[model samples]
Target: MTSSLRYWKKNNLTYVLHIPPHPIPKSPQASPSKTHVPLRPVSPLQNRTDIVVDHTKWGKILGRIGSESIHIPKVLSKADVHTLTAYIAYLTSSGHPREVKELLWALFPELNTSKYPSNSEEHSHRALGRKGLLTTYRRAIFLGPVFLSAVLNALYKSNQPILADRIWTLAKKAERLSWARKLLPNVKPWIMGPHAYTVMINCYSSLARRQYWRMVLRPQRLNYRTAIASVWGTLRYKCQILPRPLPSHQVMELMHDLMRHAALVVFRRFMNLRHDYAEIPEMRRWLAEKDIPKPDARFFNAALRAFRPRTPPMRKSWYRRQLRDAKFNLDFKGVLPNSNDGWNGSLHEVAKNMIHAGFPLPPGLQPLFVGRLRGFDLPVVHGPDRGPFAYRPQKIHPWLRYRLHTPKEKGLPVSRAYPQFREVLAQRRRHRRSRKRQRNRRAEQDAQRVAPKVLSL
Candidate 1:
């Protein structure tokens, strides 16, 4: 009864306070009747609703660049590209990945045009410095790859490899076009950096990872595992674009880490998280083909770990770190058979490589040809005090650690396609060719309509 009385009181207050306003009195005179003009019928697919983001709103979002209103423009322009690219960089770096993904998707359809407006092509403007020296430059602040790898990275980050690959292809095409046209003889061709190659390598890894994982949880069988895997194998075919950074101590460490990641690819065979098979020799060939780090202790150890059996009661996640590493009380002794036991095929070959890689082993384990496994714990960390090094694999975020499930995160992204998956996956690329084809089809239809109108006239 008390609850019913409270509800009645709330309703009475709403009724008293929220009465609808009456319409205002208007002029009694009727307006003139208007003639109707024929118009193009709108399609359900075409919804052109443009919302202009005011200066204050965008300024706050982009952080103190002064007042600049951002609106949807009809043509693809350099200013739009530069602004959107800058916005993407800010989103990725600021750790607003969701915003980054959204901004990328929204901008792709807007920026996927081949045509730049005439006026927007180049504008020569000068700004005055304190000493009265002039600065002639693009006032809109446009500096990025012609293909927009930033957007490509964004797409990859969102797990859109199919789209990202299209962006990469366009980037190569643009680079060639620049060279063929000799547009800027002075400027060197735009080549992707080390990180970009690594990202592509990682992207292929992810595609394979997805296709593989989906199969396990699947209702049926699928192809495309070999398709994605081959992408990595063929990466170095364009030898010119591949980064060959001088292997300083830092570079060596980077290469070594990448080598282990390659081994990881071997473990899973690029389909899913729990591996399909461990292909050791294929990895060595990949490393050699890329001409990066050679086999090291850590690399071989990773290969051996990849061979760690995924049996019942022991998780695939459990073997993420070195199974032989004493850090988790998982020693290599458990997996090896008695010395009298027979070993065969690729298993024998990988074991030999691991032995040579200075991997530790227990008594009575068969050490493969031309290599010896030491009977002690190898140092957990490799390298000097401050160079590229591996430390204790912390689970606070990574044992594929994702302790927090909220919008605000704790630890690193879980191990999915590649290690440090988030690091490799960056900005976006779009399905530009498909978009362009659709736009052209629409234009052709418009031309057909206009031709009929002209004939009638």
Candidate 2:
């Protein structure tokens, strides 16, 4: 509905009234031409579309920053790197992992470069190349701990432990030990989520093992794990004030896995010193006090395998006892005799090692070692075998089960991808703003029409 107003004044009196018309409904598609921009409405069902759009927007911004040169570190200043950090965090939170990888790739194209030739001339070039790569890594570190932690988590989810450790080293170098110690607890909810913690555990443990091997092979260089351990030792001591039992039970399983791996790494390192049986009991007590997950059979097997000797040491009996205790613990605790995942062969290998070491096999463990039993024994008889097989379907939690899987989201409509149409669209926006003048002129004409009516009245 619309109304027109008219006013008339005579001497000391004035009157005004408006002629009104009945309300009229406007058409839904009335100015379709003006509303031609092809904006896609995000569907709540598939979040990936929204993630892609946001990633694309930030990626374009980063791309523009890198457009000046191939050397991204040289091109982008510290402020720009900080800005990219927020974008990285957002991508991580979205859970659309590919976008994060793509954004990283866009910014760091040098990661894809292959190894250069090995000539002396090329050696100099290679050195320069290494220098350039280090500079870029410095830029990545400038993104700060939060972003680095997110990258570490993503790398772990993608099962790239090697890259995760490299990033961890880069993070340590970029940020001071004191700063990380102070910041880690505060930023943990966002940066040190379960995935990040798991990756950290994996990184520390693997590095510790590598350091032990290096000491065995080349004692000339100081152990690499010692540096990491020193930093962690300080952090752990400072972190005594941290609350126990993390908030999300959803990730408790993963958290336990992390703790178990960390425990094994520490245990393995201690055993590597002199096949120390004392360290095992101490480790158990230490882990218990720390509220870390108790070490499982796999942990014990890993420790045993690490000490498998070419020539038997004086503590051979002690090592055998450790294996026996591990077997006893496996039986006592009723932990899975073998891993559910087909990938794990450590338990079997350790059993064979024990047999070869002149140690008597634990009763009934021989069948498991021989591959007769796969895992937990189930009371099922398949076909006519009537055999108790080691197979059982796991019970999934109600929250973990889902009937609807998220469908993949489609990208932007084809119309927006055309350059000519985009240019036209820009021109249309300009003209749309210019139409304000026409609207003003129309207002002026309406005022003139009302004035003539008022004069006649």
Candidate 3:
């Protein structure tokens, strides 16, 4: 539940808007963990007719609520909260971006709940005392990792970035309550775990990818793609801090399993020249670890793409063999055929470069790029009869390639996520400094203005 407190000076009143948590719905990629939400079976009649009718009816109902302040005659109960969550999930999944804002508006972003008892078993309709509400600094957080991750996923799939951004912003801001003194509890689950941040990152990556394909014939905007990379990088560094952040490919698999699309992040990493050197070995070791969960073949396929000139022949052959033998990867999950890479074989000449560069190729694969593959190659994927980029591969620049080795602690070998992790620290430092400057400037201006008042007094 996302609950917030607001003080209204007009009537000397404060309201705590408490939105309760909803049970997780069944999804195609729904985790094996049991969900509180019950499965509702749909017959063909309901699926084709009833669902459409209900979806349309709700769409109309939501549309009618334009900018109007809604009044709940009664305090929302657990049942009410579940209903709201279910409706939101249903509407969101139905692709009804139309009046979703109105639906969101109905979420009680500004509910007056101060007079009610905080510890009350029920959401009381009657107003109560103020002192109790004012004295207590702690706020209840009902938004769990499970709920938030699901909600974020639904919002993104529904093309509700604005709502998604607002949720993310709220979750991020909950880190610090600048207005009040107390810290929030259990906030990390909302923002960090469950790929909540990754959902948004994947959204940006998807957009960037669409732009790349749209501009294949024309001169693509390099800076635009660079900006997208920077944004996702900053978020990964700032918002997500796993003691052991999974490598980019694992993150990519999580995305594919969740969203059913190939994430460009994996491709971008594969195309990085230095990626094969630093990241591939780390993946190999990670897979070899007995403690880690059984390796997914999709993950193995991703590693195969990381092969480059510097990669040892033996290791390359071994990776190919691992991919070839299905038994090695254990039980395979997710969409059967290459949905992770959107079922596309070519990206920035990776397939082509690997073949021509003397790297072992998995069965029935060929090179798609010509010349020296380096520095940000735009994927020129086409239908059947596909050829290489016909020129040398243009890979993303290796600015971070010139690194001085610094030894680290024992566990979890430093993989590709290290640079972004480092950047994230610097990014936080820069943010703090920037904020300090703004705060000081505001304070100085206030002092300067107050100086004349002091002199006059």
Candidate 4:
């Protein structure tokens, strides 16, 4: 018998069976051949002494990259360690911009450096360290708008308006106007400009559209939309509190300019097909309340360009409106198509050049311009079509062109008598027959079950 095999005594039977040693053997001093070996513990903490804790090299690298003031765990739990390992392993997996701020909050709740007062002089200056601190910082640009506002104030106090403007641009891109509204007072005359106001109005309109879409899709989440409304209200209230807020007329002028220059941003949600013609009255009423005038043909044309042709009737109505608007004089805004050169050029400059070059009037202009152009017999300038300035045609593959252009008759093989085709037809016929029989049987059984009993009674 092998040395590892041993016999165990029971009642006095002559049978033999192999037996293993005790799970925890005696000490080495007690037995030279066998020594005690530690068994697996029921609780993880029971074997805590056996486990070694160390900072992950990559985690250390990330720590150096992220904000030093922001806390990152030195020793992670098993779950956190597993999560960190997975995050590292699948490094290419991406998160949406909307979730970035939430992720920062989830990872580190104490990342409120912006909440500190700016008047702290030296201590505040030290806390405000390098801009690179936020480059890899766990927090997102949107959530750091307050931090940006504070930084903008500091930049302005230090006579760095250009840097402050750059920061404002970044905050605008992140769509954090709620935080940005706080900086408007300090920024002063710059924020009162038409361009800045246009951007702000566009931001509000975008938020309104987003909230409106959410409210439509989820009636139960109405509170979220309400909260967005409250935020807007808060913004307006803040403007009122400003020592020198832009006048109400200036606000109206800003809206008018935005409607003329960037109508798509203002009217898309209100005018799109997802909203019905029945809502037009409501829209008009709302516009009147907001002191926004009815849009001209140019504005409608810009707005309609953004609409998908998914609904033919609504799209047809939009085209009709565009035609009606074109009956008046055309005073176009923004860049004309087909010429990238004229974008930076002023309206007067473009008109002067067109007069000098004798180029035909651009489309989407009023009928009067068209009439004048037709009468002049000017050379037609075949520039890009007038529509949404951002629209670009998607490139299609040559190989897939056949699939798109192929006729129904050509889609299927002409060889219908092939074995595979025959098999398919045979299966379909069998399925049809089976279905008919099942229906007939069910009918007969149901009729019999429903029939009255006469003689049996």
Q: Best candidate per lDDT, number?
A: 2
Q: State the RMSD for candidate 1.
A: 27.7
lDDT by residue (1-457, candidate 3, tens digit) is 2222111122433222223344455786765443343333333343232233223565445433521357876765555445655766676667764455565444423312344433334545322323333222122134333444556667778766546655554444442232222454333312134245456555544443331211111122123322233333233333233354545554554433332223434334334423333343453232232332222223324333332222233444554453444333333542132324222443334444433433333322212121223321343322232224343332322111111112232334446699999999999999999999999999999999999999999
Q: Residue by residue across 176-283, what tens digits does model 1's lDDT show?
A: 443332444444333333334435545554443331121111222223332233332232222212244232443334333443355454333312211211233353
Estimate every model's Cα lDDT from 0 to 1.
0.38, 0.44, 0.40, 0.35
Off by over 4 Å in 1: 1-84, 93-149, 172-183, 211-457
Model 2 per-residue lDDT tens digits across residues 13-92:
43334454444547755542221223233233322222222234665554344323444464654556557667766666
Query: What would you estimate as the lDDT of candidate 4?
Result: 0.35
**Best candidate according to TM-score:** 1
TM-scores of all candidate predictions against the true structure: 0.29, 0.28, 0.27, 0.24
Per-residue lDDT tens digits for candidate 4, residues 350-444, read 23333443333333221223323332224444434343435443332112200111112222334446889889999999999999999999999
lDDT of 2: 0.44
Q: After superposition, how far is residue 269 of candidate 2 from its true place, in Å?
A: 11
Cα displacement (angstroms), candidate 2, residue 57, comes to: 33
What is the C-alpha local distance difference test score of candidate 3? 0.40
